[model samples]
Target: MPSELVFCHPDGGIYGLQFPMSNSISQLDISTMKELSNFVNLLSRHKNLSSIDLEFHRKGDVRAQRIINHAFSLNVQQLTIACLFKKNKKYSHDERVAFPLSLSGSKTLEHLSLRGSCGLFDEEIVLTSAQRFSSLTTLLLHSITLYDGFLSMCPNLKNLTLFSYRMTGSPVLRISHPQLSNLTLEKGECFTHTVNGGRFHVSAPELASLHFFGFCPQMFTTGDGFPCLENAHLSFHSRLECISGSYAPTIVNLLQQFRNVKHLTLSMEIIERLNSSEELISHRPCPLANLKSLTLLPEVATFVQHKHTRVIMSPEVQKYLLSSSPKATLTEVLTLI
Candidate 1:
C-alpha cells in the first residue's frame, strides 16, 4: 500500500505505486508565476526527476538556461524547450542563444527538443558546436539550421525531426543509426543547396516512419533513396508555393519512390489549393499503391467544394482516386469535413 513498495515484475505488467505519506497536500500552482526559486532548488535534489517539459511564453527572459541546467542536475532524461519568439533573424545571428547547444547539466540526456523560436540559430553554430549530449537518442528542433554536426555526431539518434530547418550551405550527412525508426520534417526557409556530387545516403536501415510538413514533395531521387520508408506524411500550409516542375511533377516520383508506403497523410493545402481548378485532380488516379490509410482533413474537403475554384472531384473521380492503386486500400481512413 506504500508508494515505495509499488513495483512491476519484469515478465509481468506495470504495477501502481501507492503513496503512504499521511499529510495534507497543498495545491501549488506554478502557472500563477510563483517566485519559487527556493522550492525549485529543493526539487532539484530529487534524482528521480528524470523527465521534464517546459513552455515559456511572455515570461520575459527569466534565466531559462539556469532552470534547464538545474533540471539536468536532477537527472532529467528528456528536455523540451518551447519558447515564444517573434521573428528576429538579427537576434539569432548576433546572439549565440542557440549556442551551448548541448546540455551541460545532465550529460546523460536521452531526448532533447527545441522548438517555436524563429531565427534563433544559424546553420554553422549548430553543426560544429561541441556536444556533451552523447547519450541523446531522440532530437527535435524547429526554427534553426542543421549542420554536419547533427548528422555525424548523433550516431545514437533513433528519431529526428527538424521544424523550420533553415540552412545556408549544403551540409554533408553521414547518418547511420540502425535504431532510427521515425523522422519528421517541418517547414523552414529554403535550404541553401550546394552542388552535391555524391549520392544521398541513409546510414540508418531501421527507419520505418516519416512525416514531411510543408515538404516540396516533388524532390524525387532514384538510386538508394528512401529504401525502407513505410509511412509518409505531407503537411502543406497556406503560404506554401506550388511550383510546376518542382512540387506538382514531383508528386509522381514521390509516390513512386515510396511505392510500398502503407499510410499517407496529405495536408489540406496540398489536396485543396494545389489545383487552380478542382478538375485537374479529378482525372489523376491516386498514385500510391500500398497506401492503407488516407486522412482527408476539413480544409481539403472545403477546397474541393468551391465551384469556380476548379474541378473538384465528384463521386465519379473520388471512385477513381481510390481505385487507382490496387494495393492503395484505405482500411481505416478519415474523410474529415
Candidate 2:
C-alpha cells in the first residue's frame, strides 16, 4: 500500500481488514463514513499525519465529522473536504449541510480547501463575528455557496483560489485583503447569464499576481487597482454563442485594471474577440502600459483532430495589443490537449 490510502467503493467490506501501518504514512484519503470508522484505529498508531482529505458522497455524517475533528486535534497542517452530495440534484434548503465550523479552529492548519456543492453559511450557522484562521495562508473554495462576511475571518490569508463559487443575496462579491498576494477566480455557469447580474470587486493592495479564466463578468473592479501586481493570466472560454456586443468593451475595461502588470498572458479566445472589434481597438489605447513580457496562448486540439496545429495572429491584432507597451517582448505558447 502507498503512504496514502484512497478509499473508494471497495468490492468487499473494510471492517475485518488489517492495514499495515508505517511511519511514512502521513496522509489519509477517505470517501465514506464506513471507511473513516475503520481507519479511526489506524490514526492513533500513525500520529504524524500531516494531511487529511475527505469526500462525502451522500449526506454528512456526524461520525465522519468526529474523525475529522480528531485528525485536526493532531498536527495535521493541510485539510481538504469535498462534499459530493450536492452534485446534480436540487436540494431543499433544510437538506443542505453547513461546513463544520469546528475545523476552522485548527491552529496548525496552513492550507484548507473546501469544494463540491455545499453551503458554507446558513441560518443555523451565521458568521456574526470573525472566526479567525490565524495560521491559514492559502484557501481554495470551489462550487460553494458563500456569503459576504466569510472571507473576513482569514486575516493573514495570502493566496485564495475560487472556482465556480456562488454568492448568496449579493450581486457584488467583494474581496479586500491587506496581506493577499495572489488571487484566482474561475467563472462557472452560475454567473454566465446576465440575469444574475453577478460581478467581482477586488481590493488587494499587496496582490502581485492574478489569474482569471472563463467568461468576463459584467463588472470587474480592483478598488484603486493592484499597485503591487506583477503578473496576470486571463484565459477566456470559447463560447461564442454567449458572446454579446458588450463583450469586447468588458474585456477592454477589465484589462485596464491590470495596466501596471509586468508580465501578462492571454488566451486565443480573448485575442479573437478583440480582433473582431477593430473599430473599438482603433479608438481606445492599449490597457497595459508597463508590460515587460506578453505571452499568447493559441488554441490547440489533440492529435485526433488536425484542425488547429499552429498559432495564428494577424498583424493588426498584434499592433493593437502592443500599442502602449511597444518594447515588451512577445512569446507564443501552444499546448496539445
Candidate 3:
C-alpha cells in the first residue's frame, strides 16, 4: 500500500475509490454507508489498511454493522465508530445491538473510541467484547453510563477517558487497573436522579497523570498512595458551596490525598472554596510536598478581546496554597476561552 484514503459524509457513502499509484490503501473513514455491498466490495481488496473510522446516523444498524464487519476483518490498529445522536429521534434497539458487533474479532486493535450512547444493555456486551483485544492500550468513552465491571475487563488498557456520564443510584466505581497510568474524568454530572451520590475508589498504583474537569466526584477513596502521579488538574463549579457548607474541608481532604502530585491545576472557584474558611486550614495544614507547578484557571478571561490578561490572587489565598508547598513558585493563572 502506498496511499491513504479518507471519505467522510454526513448522509451517504462514498461511491468511488481513488488511489495514487498503489492497489492497497492505508487508512479509510467511510461514513454512513448507504451501499454496504459497494463498501464491502471496495474494502475487501485492500488488506494493508491499518486505521478505519466509521460514522453512522441514528438507526442505521444494518449498514453500520456491515461496514464494521468489513473494517474489523483487516489488521487494523485504530478503529473509531460513532453512532451519532439525533435530537428528535431515539436510538432503536437494533442499533444498540449492532454497536458491539462491530468490534468483534478485534485482536490487534490498540486505540478504540466509541462515542454516543450505545444504551445500557449493549454496553455490557461491548465491555465483555473489549476484553478480547489483548493489544488494546487507549480507550475513550463519551456520553456513556459506566459501572464497576467495565474497567476490570480491560487489563491491558493504559489510558482511559470518560466524558459526560449520567450516573444514578449512588454507584461505587473502583479503578484498580495497575497498568493504567493516565486517567481523565470530565463533564460528569453524578447523582442527580438519586438522593445519595456515588463513590469512586481508585487503586491505580501506576497512575502518573490525572485530569478532572467540569464536575467534581461525589467522593473519592484511594486504595493506596498514588506514588507515581506527576500531574493533576482539578476544577469545580462555584455552586458546590450551596450543596454543603463544609465543602471546604471535603475539597481540602481531596487535595491532601494527592500528596505526591508535582504539577497541579485548580480553578478560581476551588481556590475560593478552600480559602473560604480559614479555620479549617489553621486546624489542619494540608501540604503538597512534591508539588512543583501550580496553575490557576479561574483568572482566565472568557473572551479573546477582554482586557484582563493577568489575574491577581489575594495574599491570604496565595499564602494558604503556598504554605503547603513552600518550594512552589508563585501560582500561575491562565484564562479558559
Q: Which candidate tops TM-score? A: 3
Highest lDDT against the true fold, candidate: 2
Task: Please give, for residues 300-326, the per-residue lDDT of candidate 1 as tens digits.
Answer: 331224333222434543453456555
> Where does candidate 1 have its weakest 10-residue lDDT segment?
9-18
| Candidate 3: Cα lDDT at 78 | 80
Q: What CA RMSD would candidate 3 show?
A: 6.1
> Candidate 3, 196: how far from true, in Å?
9.4
Lowest summed lDDT across 10 adjacent residues in model 3 is found at 122-131
Ranking by lDDT: 2, 3, 1
Q: Identify the superior model by lDDT, candidate 1 or candidate 3.
A: 3
lDDT of 3 by residue, 1-337 (tens): 5354655444433222334456664444444344456667877787656677666554444665566666666767887766654433364444434224324656788887767653443322222233356777898887655444656656787999977654433377677787889998875553243322345778888989988765445677787768888898887654432235456666676777778888888877566665566666665555677788788876322223334444455666666566768788656556455
| Predicted candidate 2 versus true structure: per-residue lDDT over 183-289, tens digit per residue | 99876444533432257888898999999876656677777788789999987655543245467777777777777889999887677777777677676677678
Candidate 2 segments whose C-alpha is farther than 4 A from its true place: 1-49, 69-75, 86-103, 117-130, 191-197, 240-242, 276-284, 298-317, 332-336
lDDT for predicted candidate 2 compared with the true structure:
0.66
Cα-based TM-score, every candidate: 0.58, 0.70, 0.74
**Runs off by more than 4 Å, candidate 1:** 1-44, 55-62, 85-102, 105-107, 119-132, 168-176, 190-203, 215-223, 236-241, 248-250, 266-289, 293-327, 330-337
Total backbone clashes of candidate 2, pairs 3 or more residues apart or in separate chains: 0
lDDT of each: 0.51, 0.66, 0.62
